[model samples]
Target: MGKKAEILERLGGIAPALRRYSRALCAGAGHTLSDELVQSALQSVGARIRARELRPADLQEARLEAYAALTASAGKRLTDASRPTPRHPPIVHGLAELSLDDRAALLLVSLEGMGYDAAARVLGIRREALLAQLMRARAKLGVVGLPPADAESGARRAASHLRIVK
Candidate 1:
């Protein structure tokens, strides 16, 4: 294949993961916005690749670059004052409550399954800072281990609200 075709192929391989990450990143913003973010990231990466500004040595490197681009795009969107707030699911609302840095840290590690070093590189932060962000994000999301009694009651209360529909 030609160089352009090869680049396209490489990008295609990582597109699914990018979509998933974008969805998680834009959780409360709706799928349309998430999809737009993915498209924007793809275009940015493509341009860089064509301009010889970003030359990935491997698929993993390419994926990280794409993620970094998407995260940057998400940050820009979050800072736009004219953007309207929309209602989202409880879990999405919880994610939206997090600061951009906290959300990016939490999602990159937990949702994208990136290592601390790789995720830190993507966020342009040190490993220690990344760990601190992860801790703060987890604490904010109430991801701590609850006591046995509280766990049982919390589980029961959560289960009580469940309904089965045919």
Candidate 2:
């Protein structure tokens, strides 16, 4: 097959993961938020591919690069975006409220499924700094939007299921 076909195939394979990351980025913020970011990211990736500016070593790299680009763009965008929407979960809302560096640091590690080293590389920060930022972000998230009392019992039930059988 042709190079274009190959690229298309690679993009198709990574689409689900991209969607997941985008969803995680804006989880509970609103359904369309992630979709918008994904579209914007895809547009950027397509342009780069057409310009031959980005070279993917393999399908996975292509996916990673695409994700990196999106995360970077979204990080920048989040700062200028408006106030917290009700649809946003407490955790996701807190993330959105953070500075781009902190938000990107946390999302790249947690939502993007990237390790500390990889996230640091993407954020251009030292690994230790990234970890510290992630810690602060998580702590801030915990303090925001405490869950309702009604959810506690459900959480306990879910926790109980994790008990291992000997």
Which candidate tops lDDT? 1
Query: Following a full C-alpha superposition, what root-mean-square deviation does model 2 have from the true structure?
Result: 6.8
C-alpha lDDT (0 to 100) for residue 44 of candidate 2: 75
Which one wins on TM-score? 1
The 0-to-1 C-alpha lDDT of every candidate, in the order given, reads 0.72, 0.63
lDDT of 2 at 73: 68
lDDT of 1 by residue, 1-166 (tens): 8755586577877777888777767755666877888888888888888888888776677778889999999988864332325544454555666788987897888667789999999999999999999888767666523211246456554322111100
Worst 10 residues of 2 by lDDT: 157-166
TM-score, structure 1 vs. true = 0.77
